[model samples]
Target: MHSWPTTTLPELPDTPARREPVRMFDPSRQAVVALTEPGQQRASMYVCGITPYDATHLGHAATYVGFDVLNRTWRDMGLEVRYASNVTDVDDPLLERANATGVDWRELAAQQTALYARDMTALEVIAPDFYVAATESIPAVVEAVEYLLVHNLAYRVPVSETVPAPLTPGAADIYADIQAIASFGEISHLDAAAMTKLFATRGGDPDRPGKRDALDPLLWRAARAGEPHWPGSGLGDGRPGWHIECAVIARGTLGDAFDLQGGGRDLVFPHHEMSTAHTSALEGRARDLAPAGARHHTHMGLVAYRGEKMSKSLGNLVLVSRLLESGYEPAAIRVALFNHRLHQDWEWFDTDMQAAAQRVAWWRTALSGYGGADPLVFLDEARLALRDNLDTPRALAAMDAWATRTLELARDGDDGVAGAAGLVSRGLTALLGIML
Candidate 1:
């Protein structure tokens, strides 16, 4: 598993006010729900991670930062958060990018994955309890595919491709029978036409002549020359498929009925939906596509730039490392992101960084002097705002109000206000994961 230092949580003051339970918007339910069940102290979540083909982009950072805030909020509310995530270290995109750049795929994945870890560390994201590579869980993946094939949830289909050294004639690839799942559309909620269109563009083979539905996801791909292959337990000499990777990893780490399944909004359709389906097939009963029976499907909004969503394929990436190298403070960049709601679709502007820097400067100035307003008020406001759907802008506005009050009243310099400013600053760090 990938590792990083633990972000220490701020301790409660002499009298930490009773905190409200965290409530996040669940897209599947179309309603805001408590993060954990009643009387439940421990919460489990699995978020999909990057494919590790390139540097960590701002879009990528935004997702992690948003969830980082969520992680902080949960701990503040006194819930034990067991978070797990995966790096798709052996996917098609990594191989394609490696081939295009003439670098070994393994080396490319390693270099980029290390860079991603550095960016996350610089941003101070609390690393997951289980941050594993897909390659690390192949034995578990094989067992999952074995379960699916045994229960008749997956089938084989033929492909016509040339290889330098061929062994089996009419080599067949295994596909999950989505038709067998009772809750295929519960998560995506799309009609056949929309699903088919999206499947074709989003790492799917809609045009492939298959024996089942066009939406049936690949379970095992037969070995192809010049591509990485793994033992597939008699299915063929190919690695596990995209959705199955997440299914096996998530189920293996978090177990069944985890509290939340989270990722960027783009993964709602094929990735999470099909992974959830695979989980259902493995467990041998449908939880309405709540695979491993996740209670909530929490998806962060997409980040867009220059009139299009920021994506690797588009090549309009604003990398986090590049911004740091350009002399932006990590705290300032985090404040810029905090200016927007986590679930709102917003575009990035150059001026955003400037504004965030100015905010951080003002905050530091406030912290250096004595203030009048009760520091607990700032703590209460930030926690309340963030606990509800991660309304970061509201939380930021509360901090600004506290800072403005502090600066405005510094001339009266209450020596009795010992550590008042420090309390508020630490509250900001603890509640919002912002370093003031």
Candidate 2:
């Protein structure tokens, strides 16, 4: 059994007094919104983890740091927050990469996971309350899938000795039914036509028996020779699909309902949408189960290089470990990333990182000579900006101003000004994990 924290959920505030704005990408509106939940004091978050096939890159760093800042800001606001990110130890990428490298899949997954943990620590990202691995949660995945089957949300397709090419049009009803839930589009952002095209490429031909729709994804993929497989109920001898692992882990760790669900913009469709659908199906069967009402918000930042997506195959990736190896300060990386708006894509470049390093150096120097000044005024302004849609650039600008003004006061030997600068530095270091 998984052990969860026994903390009580925070009570929602009465009358929804304009707490800081939350940045959200609503697929239905096709636009981003800066809003807050009514009466909710705490925020819960779940960001997808790496698939463990490649090194953790700048793209990965941007996503994690963006959320780390959000989590830090929320905690600073006195809200009890619980964050979770899962490790996808079992997947197609892991298996394929292991085979090509002639290494054991388990060893590769463990090595990459450890490297990721080291990188996250260097970036000063807070450790999630629940750091789950799919292999460890097989029982939970089975239980959730069983619940769905019992409730008629999921059905088994009989597979024969021979694997089919893809799914056929004959199984359209099952696919359509899965997509009808309220939050179906929250993940994929695709209309019916686009969805059909997208899934077709991954689907096998329907003429073969035991095949469903071409787009119908695997809730459980039957094990092949020499591949990892778990034996249990419903799924028989197979491994859980990529999407189902996340749904099962989230439901198992956070319970059926929680405050917030988050991930990169990439996961909105298919992965996130499918998870929502599965959960809704489960909820419909049991009265106690209901799709968690948390805002399925996504961040829009973390742009890739040269208009190309970051991928291991492309080999244009900048690994976080590599950056650290090159003597780049982790604090610089964190500040540069946090300086951008959460829902906007900020381009990655060498000069951008250099700028962040310079800024950190400037802040540290500015605080060396501080006299008592009202630090709260500066802290409050920055905090408010962060809460109001995660205006990181604006918040960073404010810090720059504080640094400039403090330097002016320090030069004139104003004891009060020097004191205030010290307080400001301390508060930022403590709250934002930005060390002077």
Candidate 3:
């Protein structure tokens, strides 16, 4: 059985020094918010994991790297963070890709998920405290759906007329009551037309038969012929929908009101909005659960390649494994990623890679044969920089300034310069998750 975190709520620290908070731009609030509460050293977070079809692209890496910094920053501040993420191991994209390649969906999901795990490890992303896959958490999903249904927040309807028949018993489309949640469209600020259009493109069948509203998202999808099935009391053989998967996994792992929720900027729309709505509705029905507020919602910026977004559809994805095979070290990739603000979208280029490689080389030479000093003093500058919304660029600049000073001192034959440089190098590696 998967071990779950204790349901006991976290307490705020009594000491003022421990209350020193880190601020971040919350997309939900549309302003900067304190991510850590005064007197609190515990954080709960959930990031939507990959579907594992086309796994671990640079864009994907960029998002995880941003959140990894969040995790690192919290820990650096002496906080105990419980982070959870869900793997959409049984989603439409996986099935479609598997069918196209004539491979079993299970085989494809396992292969790509393994690849993603390897890529995350290569990039030195901190593993989530509780990582659950969709297939693994189906029962939890069904339970949540049942909760929603009992509360009249969800209802079953006929499957999409678009999907040709031989639909199984539990195959009906279960829709969430999108209207029940206040501030439904506030997160994305998408107009009706835009929401409808985006929904159709990103996992919503706007034209599906019996949908209550144009924006009502699916909670449970009934099984179809030749698709994977999980037997359930009322959910039928069909699996959970994309949005519901995050809601259930997060609630099951992190409980009702987590400290933070993060994902790519693209998820700001139907995916995140729907997840929040589902959680909100569920919270309303369960009186014991806190009214999960508009908490700190952070999003990593989109990464582009050439003139366009690096998407699987574009066939222009720059995979992490591909870059590694081309002889670029993972440290170089980490440096390149931190070259910009985590929330800023930028294009990937050869110049970025070259500059990062140069930075890594410089650090290696500067710290060579240097007996280490207390890394705390050297890390203080980075800590300040990162406190300002994970300002990696500013932090990198600080490291650069220190490196220049160390080089000058070395040229002057100062005995203390080597130790200082070693301290700075180690601090950078620890803070940035990039090895020196």
TM-score of each: 0.96, 0.85, 0.91
Give the alpha carbon lDDT tens digit for every residue of 1-436 in model 3.
Answer: 2312222222222322223566888766778888877678588899998888876888999999888887877876778889888889998889899999999998988888888888888887888889898999888888889889988888889664454453663357688888777767767777899999999888898887677898899888777777887876776766788998888788888887888888988898888888877888777832323225336688888888888988887877888998888888998898899998878788888688889889989877767647333334457767777788888988888777666666666677764533555556546655678777
Please give the lDDT score at residue 185 for candidate 3.
70
Better of 1 and 2 by TM-score: 1
lDDT of each: 0.83, 0.66, 0.77
lDDT of candidate 3 at residue 339, scale 0 to 100: 91
Which is the better candidate, 1 or 2, if ranked by lDDT? 1
| Backbone-clash count (model 2) | 27
Q: Worst 10-residue stretch by lDDT in candidate 3? A: 3-12
In model 3, the clashing pairs are 13-39, 171-222, 223-238
Write one digit per residue (lDDT tens) for candidate 1, span 303-385: 88888999999998889999999999899989998898867778888789999998899889888764446788888888778
Arrange candidates by lDDT, descending: 1, 3, 2
Clash number by candidate, in order: 0, 27, 3
The better candidate by TM-score, 2 or 3, is 3
